[model samples]
Target: MYRYDEFDRRFVNGRVEEFRDQVQRRLAGELTEDEFRPLRLMNGVYLQLHAYMLRVAIPYGTLSSAKLRGLAHIARRYDKGYGHFTTRQNIQFNWIRLEDVPDILDDLAKVELHAIQTSGNCIRNVSADHFASAARDELADPRVYAEILRQWSSLHPEFTYLPRKFKIAVSGSTHDRAAIQVHDIGLQIVENAAGERGFTVYVGGGLGRTPMVAKKVREFLPESELLSYCEAILRVYNQFGRRDNKYKARVKILLHEAGLDEVRRQVEEEYEDIKSRDALTLPHDEIDAIAAYFAPPAFETLPERSETLERAKVVDTALADFVARNLAPHRSPGYGIVTVSLKSVGSVPGDATAEQMEAIADLAERYSFDELRVSHEQNLVLPHVRLDDVPALFAELQKAGVATGNAGLITDSICCPGLDYCSLANARSIPLAQRISERFADLSRQHEIGDLKIKISGCINACGHHHVAHIGILGVDRKGEEFYQITLGGSGDETCSIGSIVGRGFSSDDIVDAIETVVNTYIAQRSSPEEPFLAFFRRVGEAPFKEALYGAAPAAA
Candidate 1:
């Protein structure tokens, strides 16, 4: 993790005091609600349907045990007993009091965490692969660059207010775990034929009312020019992105209106002017210094497999199931990357109680080198756990009630704080997610479904990333009644594609059955159990599933 320097400490403390005064003004009636809106948003506070919501940034999803404890303290002292982890790898407290925000910000600053840029039309928290340095196939730690971008973009005067909010994601692995393709800007670390490292840059990818996958802007931009290239892209967007209509303000909309070729041309032209500047080019030593902060943890020499884990699994079927669903191969031998599923059956997806947060902090300190990661999938990750300690960790996790072994399964869905809290939401999202999770509570059933991603959003803002899910569900209000629209064949991997709507929307009562029907239809259509839901759906388009949902697609007449 990147430690805050003296300058960082001063900057954060200054912002805390600044926001403290703003909050005091609002409470004292010196500032009206409308006047306080922009100030509050700049500090990551939102007035939701029921109460104020505070979103705190977890830079690149990395957290120290101390930082985790700090968040737990906030959850316990400030708001409700739990916080919601979002798709962007940030956390939101939904029941915050308006006057308590300053104190919360002060607590966050003490732990080197803040709500800065977690909201608003500034560069939001830069996201990266949660399995950054620990993944077996990662070319480099994307967090090194993510941290760099965070430092560069924080309070940047030039980008403080864009046409709309901007998001950037980076991935150091061949696999797109960070869902880079769906970001405003996506950078994938790649090596050229000459073995020099660079990035494959994708620009203007986003999902909302109008969803579009980013287009490749630069095939291979040298690593040294990362900042220059990113600046150039931002400059181009700022220059021409829409300002009249908020709906058409995003860079994705700009790219759609102005062709990709023209956008690339302008970005390249801007880059040519800026690339030669020493301030923009990253020096080798600076890159190395940043990377040194993320060097691998010390490891005792051991075999690849853990005999202890194997033996325990032989006796405990639950452990076996957990290992199968919740574990990922680590870059280090004799170690495993364990994903603690926050999406327990019937629970709100991506939410963790203060007690559970503290318990996870303890686990991270005791068994995972005092570091934890928040996955984009709304799960907590123990990134460097020794395989030998798996059984004990599993037991502790079981006690914490987060030992659900559904990582990429049906129950492990991505959802947003919909009508329950979000004022913009037209219908409730949590209840639907809960119902679906309980519907597929059986471990055997989830495993049989295999690598399915069900994402739900309360509205078209796409906060839950439903557009990229294998089974995307969007809640809408039809004549004051809650209904859901389903989209199938969407995915957020390397081969990214937007999902197509199956047919008409389903009533809240019938939505779960509709989802089950789609799943059953997939099972029936799959050639074998080995075929995954996504693969089968892709092989045979949405026709079969659509037919199963709305009966044969009205014979072409």
Candidate 2:
């Protein structure tokens, strides 16, 4: 994790005091609600339907045990007893009081955390693969670049207020775990034919009312010129991106209106002008300096497989199931990456209680090198757990009620704080997600359905990333009643594609059953048990699933 320097400490403390003043003004009636809107938003505060919501940034989803403890303290002292982990790898406290925000910000600053850029049109927290350094297939730690972008973009005067909010993600592995394709800017670290590292830059990818897989603007941008190329893209977007209509203000819309070729041309032209700037080009020494912060932990040599874990699994089926579903292969020998599923059956998808947070933080400190990661999938990750310690960790996790073994399964869905909290939402997302989770609560049934991602959003904002889910559900208000729309075959991995709508929307009562019908249809349609739901859906398009959901068309008369 990147430690905050003295300057960082000063900067964060200064911002805290600044916001404290603004908050005091608002409370003292010196600033009206309308006047306080942008100021509050810039500080990552939102006035939701029920109460004020505070979103704290977990940059690149990295957190130390101390930071985790700090958040747990906030959850316990400030708002409700729990906080919601979002799809962007940030956390949200939904029941915040207006006057308490300054004190909360002060507390956050003490832990070197803040809500800055977690909201607003500024380049929001630069996210990366949660398993960046730990993944077996990573070419490099993407967080090194993410941290660089964090430093470069924080309070950047030039790009502070874009036409609309911007999101950027980086993936270091061949697999796109960060969902880079659905970001405003996506960077994939790659090695060229000559073995030099660079980035495959994709621009204009986003999901909202208009979902798009990013266009490949550059085949390979030199690693040294990463900042220059990115600056060029932002400049092009800022120059021509729409300002009149907020609906069409996104860079994705700009790319759609202006052809990809023209956009690429403009970007290249801008890059040519700026590439030579000394400030933009990253030196090898600076890159190494940034990377030194993320060097691998001191690892012990041991066998690849853990005999202790194997023996425990032989006796405990729960342990066997957890190992099968929740663990990922680690880059280090005799170690594994453990994903703590926050989506327990019948619970909110991403809500973690303060007690659970503290428990996990303690476990991370004891077993996983004192580091934890928040995944874009709304789960917590123990990135470097020794395989030999798996049984003990599993037992502790079970005691904490977070030992649900459904990492990529149906119950482990990505959901948003919909109508339950979000004022912009048309339907309640939490209830729907909870119902679906309970519907497929059986671990065996979920494993059988294999690697299915069900993402739900209360509205078209796509906060839950429903557009790229295997089963995408978007809630809409029809004549003041909630109706759920379903889209099938969407995915967010390397082979990214937007899902196509199946047919008419379903009533809230029927939505869960409709999802089950789709799952059952996939199970029956699949050639074998090994065929995942996504593969089956892709093999035979949405026709079969649509027919199953909406029923077959009338026989030709």
* TM-score of each candidate structure, all chains considered together: 0.99, 0.99
Q: Write the per-residue lDDT of candidate 2 for residues 16-129, one digit (tens) a residue.
A: 889889999988999999999999999999999999999999999999999999999999999889999998989999999988998999998888899999988889999999
lDDT over C-alpha atoms for residue 338 of model 2: 99
Pairs of residues at least 3 apart in sequence or in different chains that clash in candidate 1? none
Q: How close is candidate 1 to the true structure, as a TM-score?
A: 0.99
Among all windows of ten consecutive residues in candidate 2, which has the lowest summed lDDT? 548-557
For residues 1-557, what per-residue lDDT tens digits would candidate 1 score against the true structure? 89989999999999999999999999999999999999999999998898999999999999999999999999999988999999999999999898898889999989999999998898999999999899998999999999999998999888999999999999999999999999999999999999999999999899999999999999999999999999999999888999999999999998999999999999999998996556699999999999988888997788999999999999999999999988899988899999999998899999999999999999999999999999999999999999999999999999999999899999999999999999999888999999999999988888888889999999989899999999999999999999999988899889999998888899999999999999999988799999998899889998898788888662231
Model 1: how far residue 18 lies from native, Å: 0.5
- Whole-model alpha-carbon lDDT for candidate 2: 0.93
RMSD of 2: 1.6
Q: What's the lDDT for residue 362 in model 1?
A: 100
Give candidate 1's root-mean-square deviation (CA, Å): 1.3
